[model samples]
Target: MFFNTFSWKEFLLRKIISLLTVLLLVVGCENNKKSLEPITPEDFLIIAHRGASAYAPEHTIPAYEIAQQADADYIEIDLQMTKDGVLVAMHDEKVDRTTDGVGFVIEYSLEELKQLNAGRWYNSANPGLANKEFEDLKVPTLQEIFSHFGNDVNYYIEMKSPKIYKKMEEKLVSLLIQYNLIRANGELPKVIVESFNEDSLTRLHQLEPKLPLIQLFYFKEEATLSVQHYNRLSNFASGIGVNISSVDNDFIQEVQLNGFQVYLYSINNEIEMKKALNLQANGAFTNNPDMGISVRTEFEK
Candidate 1:
């Protein structure tokens, strides 16, 4: 019969093409890694806050790729676990703001969450930057991000509502190991973990001390910090990630003096970017990485 006549030539060609495609994707992400080196304290890095978020929907692949294209040092991901225990990229505790869905993000299973339109809200919010392409963006998982970017790109993952999401630390560590981002002795980890909860960061530190931790802070009174406070946090975290407005020259000086790197968050304008660089901050998380890079390059001159 005609069906019994097998084509070894076609089969071999299909396998070769598949193999080439996978290899190319890896190479492409590698080439996109402008700052392949793990960020050291001395390095002044511009982390893409939710991946050039001002241009594309936050926490989506298009935003991440655009940030990489802008040559940012890192892509920051805020994780929220689904009902089925899959970790996905999300910022707010509720999906109402980011997606065409209502209710807490944790209540939805991965499949249920995938059904929501994660990017349409961005178009309505920012019509000037709207694109039909972004309207269909899906919420990505930690495994997916790791698979897409590989080890070449840096990952700055922020754990949200750590107390509510029990076993998050364990799951994250397992995933990091699974992705081969975990480094051996004397090798810097490809991933850095950040959170506002000291206990969560401490737990993560215990799970993997090699992975650098960043302690985040929010202040209603003021952004002032005492040496005693710094000493307390220094035990588990290598650096601090704070609101840009919460930090001033004095705050930056204090942090640097105490041997901690300062990273200002959500910096979206030239003034803020210039302020961070001029203040000698170790890093700045900006929603516009291209502008951040451009401002830094001009400032260095």
Candidate 2:
């Protein structure tokens, strides 16, 4: 009886040990799999620069709708604050070029700005593709844009002239939270804040750590970034946007190696789009999103 009891005890012990060994092996395999996974550059993002500005007046509802049809990854909006502290989409500080209004955007109240003809300028500028529906398309407030698109589309928002608008960052964060964009979980939102101002970017990072930010750089001449510059930017920004002319294969590789995403901006043609792709840019901001999407699709094929 004693011998039988001992044999049974030994068998149970062996089974327990074998089960633990299998579990350990499984856990180790999972860890190894994760470790060995390649860090692929993010899937190419075709950001519509001011909502397919090539086809329609920029920063208007019509422009955004057309961008959606073109299958852009994100609708880029340049935010400028009005006198009444309303955030509106306008790329330039002055409204003379894009709208009938001939003053700084900040000088007009949102209501006054809405009264201006935002679309007529486009029709006049591009008579070849003019549409009657483009007439009287009012300047859209940032809130209006969010309400119109909701979670259906992603936003690449730029805090234009952050230094000029002292409370822009606070107001932006508040609006983002109000829109249910600030979540407790680490999941990325459909919004990304970008600016040429580092101070604004840093303030944004402080307000919402989970929200990704991009540092935008504009260069008249070709530019090269040092490791220190990449590291400094990485401290506050998840990625960098550069003029398409300023970036090359080495620049993209260096930035990616330092774990920062690189995006080339204002690429409106097939040749530049192909060059951006060849450099393995995470994305490119394009006035012609349709062209960018087509080139990307063909490249993938």
Relative to the true structure, how large is the alpha-carbon lDDT of every model?
0.81, 0.82
Residue-level lDDT for 223 in candidate 1: 83
Worst 10 residues of 1 by lDDT: 29-38
- Residue 169, model 2: lDDT of 92
Clash pairs for candidate 1: none
> 170 in model 2: Cα distance from truth in Å?
1.1
- Measured by C-alpha RMSD in angstroms, how accurate is candidate 1? 22.1
* Residues 24-77, model 1: lDDT tens digits: 543443343221123354457889998889999999998899988998888999
Model 2, span 1-301: residue lDDT tens: 9999999999999979855644554344333321111213346989999999999999999899899999898899999999989999999999999988898988998888988999998899899989998998999998899899887777889999988786899998888888876542223347888899999998988777777788899878866665456546656777789998887775576566556678788898999999999999899999999999999999999
lDDT of 2 at 127: 98
Which runs of model 2 end up more than 4 angstroms from their true locations?
A: 1-42, 183-188
